[model samples]
Target: MFATRRADLVLILVALIWGSSYLSAKTATAALPVLAVLFARYAISALACGALIGLRRRPRRWTRDEVRSGSVLGITQAVVLAVETYGVAHTSAANAGLIISLTIVLTPLLDRREGRRLPPAFFVAAGLCVLAVGLLTSSTGLHAPRLGDALMLAAAVIRAGHVALVGRLTVGRPVNPLHLTTVQTVVGTALFLPLATPHLPELAHSSATTWYQLVYLALFCSVFAFLAQTWAVQGTSASRASLLLGTEPIWAVAIGISLGGERLTVWTTLGAALMIAGTYWGQAVERAHRTSTPMEESLRSCRTARADGAARRPGAVVASSPARSSSRSRGDTT
Candidate 1:
């Protein structure tokens, strides 16, 4: 129980850290180019993750398949982040936060296509998600959507793909999550460095405040949050992890409004609320299925045991009866 609580706490921390990530990224991007912000974020994160890998005693060598899987996952992850960073830069942190919650709905659907069927509640949650999106989109009178919102929506889709791929590739495999994170961070850094080349000199001229924001994004948001999430998920159920981590958008909204000077209208607030509720419900449904499965199995096992005992009762009664005893005695005399 203590361990479980610790894991839950860690996951919540991860959510908070991630929730603040949007604001930090937004702040950094305000001063630096998007690619430059991403470059610095990934570069620092890669070093941090590498240092973590070195701390493992008797570290196992990466298999050929692990390398291949990591490379593929890394590239996919890079795209997800690239789009997400750009989206946040162009949109309000609040919008980015709320819109990205689409991943929760998208992931199960993606998994369903991969041969896993979800419960009916999942569809209800999806419907709610759609409604929420409509509410958010119409906050500005249902005109053309902001480019940033569109990019974030796209990022959510790609992020869902990334999640689905991670599940598919890592299952029944010897690939380590730490190794995967390290590889992806390195890949992201390499991919963004060239794009950030023109702005590389801008880093030297940036304010201390901007540099601090970049550091926060790199360390807490990327490295620590990833490590915490991986560790927490290993110790908890997937549904629980989703439920806990899903709080990220709430934090994002909070930080955006309070710290980032972003405004929130009633329509936007309602949309954000709906999005959060839908995501939570979606995860809750899955968690319900996971929790009930073992109980159902145990109940079936008990019923089978009872039926077998009943089937043996007639034989036991016959052997003990007087008629059966007399018949046995006659056979012995013959």
Candidate 2:
């Protein structure tokens, strides 16, 4: 029970960290070009991951699958971050955070593993989220969405696709999360180096506060959150982990208001409430749909039996897999 409570707290902490990232990214970009900020965040993460691997007493060599999967995920993750950063730069942190939570609903539509149709109620919940976005984007009046909000909307869609891709690539594979993360950070560093080269001087001259934000983004938001979530989820149900992590947007709003001095007008406040409600409702619906699927239940039973039978074999080694981790990953797009 203590372990479970500890895991819950860790998950919530991760959520809080991720929630605060929009403001952090916004602050960093204010001091440096977006590309430079991206480069620094990725480079710092890569170095930190490399150091961790070096410190391991018996580090395993990277597997082919891990490299391939990490490369693909790295590119996608970079795109999501690029768009999200740009979006946050132009929008209020609260708006950015709330707008991006659309991923919670969008991912179910994008994820193809189930192959079963979602219930009608799921669509109803999705529609509510859409309405919330409309209100959020039209906070000033009923006109075109601000550039930042639109970009954030686009980010949500792309991030949903990325989450689905993570599940597709990593499920049932013996991919080490640490190795995969390292490869991703390296790929991101390489990808951004040329783009950020001209801005290196600017990045170097950034104030200590800006550097602190960059470090926070790289270490706490990316590396630490990923590791802690992975650890915490192992001790809790995917549903429970997701529930706690789902509080990210709330933290985002609270931090934006309390620390960033961002405000939400009546329309935006209503939008925020709607978004929170729609996401939780949608999440519950999707979870119920997934758990009640007969085919999925049968497949899960077969896999469990196979695993048990293999465990009884004379020379069998059960690899630590992220099959369940992928489910938790669906809701975790910063």
Candidate 3:
């Protein structure tokens, strides 16, 4: 029970870190290109994850299988984040947030593609209707979803697909979360390095202030944020964690409006309202599906149980994992 609450708290902090990041990204990208900012975050994220594994849990040895599995998860995660971060650099914070929030609606659609029938209320039709209204009403202007916006939309679909992937990657797999995280970060950073083109000359020529901004993003948003979230999700409900994070744009908007001196016009406000409504609505649908599912019917029934092990009698996730396992889109967020 205590662990569950702790995890929940961690997830909330993650939401705050991620929520505040929109402004940070806004600032960092002013001097850096979209790719450079993405590079720094992934590099720092990998470093932070590695440090956590080393400092906290002293494993006698890491198995090769573990390394491989972590790599798979990390790559997938890195791909999604890289695309989303870059996209955010191109679009308005409000639009990014509201669009990313549509991921909640995308989850059910992804399920359908996988051949599973989500409840009618998980309604692909309805979620899309709400989402279109949100997008159409955005004050940011309904310009034919720019390349950036299109990139972000892809990121959202990829992100939603990952929820299932996380479940798939983590199932029956008791790999240390830190270890798993490190591998992912490292692999992701490596994958992006080629495209990122980290120019030391460019950095050295940049002002000290820019470096400071980079550090804040690397440390607070990427490193500390990931540590807080991974720990938190282990204990809290993923759905709850996701919901909080999904609302990050609101935080972004508020931070920008209050501190950055941005305006919250009517179009943005209405669009944000619609977006938030759709996300919460999607969450409600997921929760209801969990409640109604029978344990014997499907293994995913375990999501409804408390994280600390007091799962409702049956252990749905107690399957066999390959130390061993084998292994998405992009999106931007508000």
- Superposing every Cα of model 2 onto the true structure, what RMSD results? 11.9
lDDT of 2 by residue, 1-88 (tens): 9999999999999999999999999999888999999999999999999999999999998899999999999999999999999999
Report the candidate with higher lDDT, 2 versus 3: 2
lDDT (C-alpha, whole model) for all candidates = 0.85, 0.94, 0.67
Q: How close is candidate 1 to the true structure, as a TM-score?
A: 0.84
lDDT of candidate 1 over 110-200, digit per residue (tens) = 8653354678997898789878877776565655668888899899999999998988888888887778878888888888888889988
What would the per-residue lDDT of candidate 3 be over residues 211-292, giving only the tens digit for each residue? 7767777788767776677667766676777766666767766776776666756666766676677667767876667655
- Native-to-model Cα distance after best TM-score fit, residue 128 in candidate 1, in Å: 1.2
Work out how many backbone clashes candidate 1 has. 0
The C-alpha stretches of model 2 lying farther than 4 A from their native spots are: 295-334
Candidate 1 wrongly placed segments (more than 4 Å): 289-334
User: Which candidate wins on TM-score?
Assistant: 2
Every candidate's CA RMSD? 8.2, 11.9, 13.1
Model 2 gets an lDDT of 0.94
Better of 2 and 3 by TM-score: 2
- Provide the lowest-lDDT 10-residue window in model 3: 325-334
Angstrom error of the Cα, residue 147, model 3: value is 3.0
